[model samples]
Target: MVEPAHPKRRRAASWILAVVLAVFVTMGAVGCSPSLGSPPCMPPEYRVNPSSAKPGEAVTVSAPDATCNPRYGSNAQIRIVFTDAMGVEVLNTTAPMTDKGGFAFTTEVPTPTAVGEVAVYAAPEGVDWCDDTGTNNRAGSGEDELEMASCAKPMKPLTITK
Candidate 1:
């Protein structure tokens, strides 16, 4: 006949199994912790001081509310486009993010001798959370085009007279 396990051995084996299970549970909890999720990602917030500027004037474009999704860190690029009333692009500048997780650009309205309006546009280089895709991806990534609402607005008309 087969001998049954001793009571002391059985108790020790049960304790070992319990400890192993506890360790596994603890590890799983840690692996699935909130901290393990993507960092708090934040979309760029474009703000232009004065919002309207005359020719020969300078405007400040700042990203004050800019922040990286805490889980993803700050990894993004910025591009600024300046266009004239004729729908002709005059200036295009790309500024990379600094270690501070923010960026800014200063542009001067050109004093055109022609009468027309000027517009400035700020767009995130890649996907933007504010975009319809709801994820920060690069532009043309099958994602909706990301643009700054304020920047997309047409600028005040400037009358050029001899």
Candidate 2:
């Protein structure tokens, strides 16, 4: 075997790399942990003001801004959907994010003048849930945030009487 000339330098470089990786793991876990909630993994949430309103009344859908964490890819353009008591889609629109995560859109509640309940829910922005792009293919080990978000999230519900 040939003797290495810079063995000391090689060891020093390895030590530095290890330290750097350790720091990264500690600092990055806060944003990437599988846990869900605010300050970390705040899942997308939505609500409508005045749970009770008249038909065709003005209403606001809020998908409040969230922590732009790197681990959980919650970057989808939040979609605001208002449906009738029968679960029929009444109003459908996409809300734009103000800063990082949360989004909001204002719309009027619709109805057929039925004296029943109305519902408002949310979902990911795009129609197709599958991502074939290299950036979001959580098919195997070592998947990115965007890929993990491909799965559907529990839709937030808001009930308002008209």
Candidate 3:
């Protein structure tokens, strides 16, 4: 006659299986699983043509790889901002994201009092929802934007030459 397994052993094995299953489920949920209906989280990129420019010169800034799906959803606008070395907002404008989440616009470089470097930053504004980060906090709480929007601020370096 064969002996039956001990009650304690059976309970331990069941507990271990439960824990392992839970871990796998959590991992899949957190992982970047495209099948889970979550788009890959990619920071919107900024592109500057003629990166180095003289004051009053026309410069074009574009973001051709920005996407709003699975986070901001449709009907989101990407705002382009130009800030001087002193952190002063010199120019600001908004562009509608294309179906492919890209936009292009031209603006004259701001002629600051002194010739210095100006930074170009872009972020999605007026988003419908913002996703929680690894820390479980709202991601996009900032000035002039939705509190829950993802604050993926991609920047481009620009030099103002004399």
Candidate 4:
């Protein structure tokens, strides 16, 4: 006949099994789970040298380096738009993501055909919500625009002139 297992031995075996199971669960969670969402994107700092320009003149808009989704998302892009007085998009360019988590972009102003009080606007790509009629929008051409309502500081739309 087999002797009954000792109480202390049984407890020890149970404790070891519990520990092993816990380790597996923890490991799986750490290795398999996607990263938690990163902090919201910082409002890009934008500047244009020679704030005023004539139609077809080259202007430069430079802003300090920044991150969109930081390390959490790929395919992140920044779009810089130049709008003429007629509220028409004259130049719109999308910059590619850099290998590092940050992206600092500088581009020469696109030449405008319409001229007269041109403005520069910058934004992250792939946004769907745009309000042209609502008060939550910028005054520009008919393009749909999303109001970045929750930024730490209200972003002033950059502008240039002819």
lDDT tens per residue, model 4, 1-162: 999999999999999999999987875555312343222334346666666655445566555544342231466565667767688877778875432223455555566446466667665454321322322222233666546544342223445544
What stretches of model 1 exceed 4 Å from their correct place?
1-42, 65-76, 99-101, 113-117, 126-162
Q: How do the residues 119-154 of candidate 1 rate in per-residue lDDT, one tens digit apiece?
A: 666655654534333333334446665565332332
- How many residue pairs clash in each candidate at the backbone level? 13, 1, 0, 2
- lDDT per residue, candidate 2, 51-142, as tens digits? 66777777776765545442324445656766666767777777665433466676666655344566666644542224424232112225
TM-score of each candidate? Answer: 0.47, 0.53, 0.59, 0.46
Which regions of candidate 3 are displaced past 4 Å?
A: 1-40, 66-75, 128-145, 148-152
Pick the lDDT winner. 3
User: Would you list the clashing residue pairs of candidate 3?
Assistant: none
Candidate lDDT scores, in order, read 0.55, 0.56, 0.66, 0.53
lDDT tens string, model 3, 43-65? 35668998888878999887765
lDDT of 4: 0.53
**TM-score, model 3 to reference:** 0.59
- Flag the better candidate by TM-score, 2 or 3: 3
Q: lDDT score, residue 44, model 4?
A: 45
Off by over 4 Å in 2: 1-25, 32-43, 70-76, 127-153
Best by TM-score: 3
* Cα deviation of 75, candidate 3, in Å: 4.2
